[model samples]
Target: MKALNATLPTQGLLNFKNLVYLDLSFSTLHNNFLKDIGKISSLKILLLSGCQLSGTIPAAKGLCELKHLLKLDMSNNDLRGTLPSCLANLTSLQQLDISSNHFIGNISISPLGTLTSLHKLQLSRNLFKIPISLLPFFNHSKLKFLDCHENEIYADIDVPNLTPKFQLETLDLSGQGDGGVFPKFLDYQHKLEYVDLSDIKMKGEFPHWLIGNNTKLYTLHLPSCSLSGPLHLPMHSHVYLSHLDISDNSFNSPIPTEIGVQFPNLYFLNLSGNGLIGDIPSSFGKMSQLIKLDLSNNRLSGIIPQDLIVGCISLFNLILSNNNLQGQIFPEQANCKELDRLLLDGNQFTGSIPYSILNCTLLNMLDVSDNHLFGSIPGWIRNMTFLRVLDISENKFSGTLPSNFVPPQIREVYLSNNRLQGPLTNAFYNCSELMTLDLSRNYFTRRIPDWFGKFPKLSYLLLGYNNLVGEIPIQLCNLGQLSLVDLSNNNLSGHVLPCITAASNKVRQEEVGTNPYMASSPAYMKQPLEFTTKSISYYFQGSILKYISGLDLSCNNLTV
Candidate 1:
């Protein structure tokens, strides 16, 4: 720390009278020595974010001396002090950002409200509090952007005269100390482009004008705000509301058939975690711009909308799990050639999976588990060369798994509780990239395949309640990644390999544990942690956490 402070020769730095910008962010600055830089009288912009500095902010008399300063950014630092009151003296200051710092004490913005040139004020992730009846400090007409989220500010917003009256476009008040009905501030801001008021306990029906008149709004996020009742959509067609996310609320009512009439430009719509019921409107098929749609964990029922699958061709993700949708699989599922993720688990969809979707070359995940799906597993599934996850568990799939069904790139395969009756040689030999393979409760009658050792990446292997006889092979220990092995209730009659048992625990703990690739990787490669917490005693986190079978695995003798 001392080395960095001494390296900045104070001699050459003082004579730079024409210096207009000085950025030393992500540098190893020590202590509260920023006041020394204020000596550069002609400095217009001073940036010190992400610097290793500490201690309270010093008096800003030297900072005020910079009469030509336009912007001052000290964010992402360890600076912990009451905001300097002298900042108001910088009449030329247009933007002030002190976010992600350790600033403490009440943020007295009354001095800032008087700054006629202040256009942007970023005091987020700090410690501040204002009266419930008083509005946030933005009374100046020049203030255009105010980001005070993740703070301790609690106000019911009663002041009508405390208006900024500026052309503010973005206001993020998420994670701040706020409650009661949402503020009627948006009713005034006609030019707002982005607004996020999530994580605040603001309740009441969805505002009519927010959906109706905020035509220029591109992003509208109000998740977990406890807003209830039918979604009262605005009837304006010119409003290009691109993203509409109102998930995790108590809004109960049928999904409006006019959803397409209002949010035609919506590319992302998440109406999950609600009490919404009725079939998805076929009018939603008109939203050609949709890329991701999540309607999971709702009371929505009836047949899945075939129009949605056929219309939105640009879609890549579709999560409709935990609903009451019935009828055969949507015939238009093949239309989405760019589809990468298809999560339709926990529903009542029946009939065979359309082999017509093999054209989606980029397909990575396919989860249709816990449904009423029947018919044989098709051999064309081998065409999905990039397929990584395929879970068809808890279904009535009969006939033998195809011999050419080589899912070399597959990681997880859950085909449990099916009518599969055949030797495991073909399935285990081809799925070399498997991380999990659960073929339990099947009618397969044959000696366990010795080729199982080929699956070097195998972690979970559940073969219980099968008609497999003979000694458990020690060659199975070749699976170094094997963690959880449930070989009980099988017709095996020999000593179990200690290495396999230990590796099975390693695999179980690892699969159930942490995959290091997930610690720092993309969302598709990552796994969510699942454990016993207080509020959620049996909570599970992850994209591929499945329940293959019950606690009991009887019917076959275990000679371990």
Candidate 2:
């Protein structure tokens, strides 16, 4: 039973002589509940996950007496210290899960090595150090699933080449150690369906054999594994494969042109942060089931293939930022209506915002900054009612700000360094959810609006290098969440309001929530907020933006 605040009576539990199963998950149990629990020798399954259990597992007459326990789960607790030696007495345990705990010690000498009947073991997010060779579990012929990620599992120079007795169906050893080699034991694992070896310093070429051998494999994540050389695919198509992420690697080859034909069922693909060159494969259009595709931060050039844009019907969250890709932003035939977050910044894309993108009605965050695009900022952007972040800065767009620019849900608007002119309008007064408004280095000429104080969540306000003229409004003091304010290089004349200082001091003590748009996907578009402070321009993004508090009224006619 979960969410029950009732105290677990150890005496009452011990009276149940035939209690074969007991689950107190997410319950608030007394610390002494387990003192007499071991008396229930008939318990075959015990689930105490999220029970708020703390300290070490009792080693005396607690869990050790449950010799007939076939399954035990104590995950998501504060349990720590070495596994009790008496735990090895549970020889019939087929499944044991102790993940997300503070348990420490080496697994080689631990009780897990003796649990030969274990078919499923989850020890992830612990402080354990396991041997890379996995020699201790060689005799566990019945084992199939083992997840021990986020630990100190390391490699040894003398790792044995002995074959394992069991064929794993799922294995996750990601984030085990740094400067380690690829697990050689995987060569013998043919029944693998899910594997995650990410964040381990395993330096090697792409393991094509992984897909060739494990025909049933569906998910393979090897991001940040120090893999190099050409990323070779299997000799034939692997229809069962779906999720694949090999991002943040050093693969220095072109993406396989026929990758779509190879893993046609892939729903998620991330090959970002690699050195891959050549044009994006047109075959990607054939992957009808694809949902999220990230190919950002590469040397890939040439225009985005039109076929891929129109064919990937289920596609969303497409990130092709920080690449050498050129040509129009979106082809007229672009039909990916499910697109949500489109990040095409830091590229050479030309022309104004395409109307074809309007088909993506679910768009939330759109970043096209640092491009060669020119023309008036589209006013139809308001139609995308779900839009939260709009970044079209560093372009040659010359026009006045649209009267009804963004949607009411807009949280961040970055249009700095563009040719946009004229006064800040009342269009932003309705954007109550706005958090960051960066319109720096534009040609806008007018008074700094007093209604800016209407935005309750406004944090970063950058209006520097504009020609606006007026007094710094005291209404700004109403923004208790104001953290960073920039009104520099303007013609505004006035004494620095003491209330402005009060607002800044108030924000310093106040905690701010993360920008919802930027927080959506950690690997997606990270729109940086540029502000000049202390005569230096710094770009802040992600979590670091929250703590960045500053006030820039420099180069203005403001007095102390």
Which model scores highest in TM-score?
2
Write one digit per residue (lDDT tens) for candidate 1, span 1-560.
Answer: 22253324445666787898887766666463566666788899888777767777666655667778899888887778676777667888899898888777655454565567878888788765543322545455677787877876465535565544566677777775656766755566777788777777776887757755566889888888888988777666734788878899898888889887677778899999988988989887888888999999998888877788788888888888889888765564557887888888889988988775676777888888889999999888888988887878888999887885746777777787788887766764767667767787688777877888888776557787677787777778787755446665667776656776465333222353355422332245322221222223232224443321112223445435
Residue 544, candidate 2: Cα error in Å is 3.6
Cα error, residue 247 of model 1, in Å, equals: 0.7
Looking at candidate 2, what is the lDDT of residue 500?
72
Task: Give the TM-scores of the predictions, in the order they appear.
Answer: 0.87, 0.92
Worst 10-residue lDDT window, candidate 1: 528-537
Please list the residue runs of candidate 1 whose C-alpha ends up more than 4 Å from where it truly belongs after superposition. Answer: 1-11, 60-64, 106-111, 129-134, 157-163, 504-560
Best by lDDT: 2
Which digits, one per residue and each the tens of the lDDT, describe model 2 over residues 1-560? 54777755556777889999999888877776665778788999999998888888888578888999999999998889999898988999999999999999988889888889999999999999887778788889999999989988677668766898989999888875864667788889999999998888887888989999999999999998899999899999999999999999999899999999998999999999998899999999989989999999998898889888998999988999989888898888887889889989988999989998888889988999998999998889989998888999998999888877799988888999999889888768789888889999998888888898888778789999999998988888887777788889999898898877765565443233344433442342267777887788888888777666778889988888
Which residue pairs come into collision in candidate 1? Answer: 483-504, 483-507, 483-508, 484-508, 509-513
Residue 518 in candidate 1 has what lDDT? Answer: 28
> Which residue pairs show backbone clashes in model 2?
none
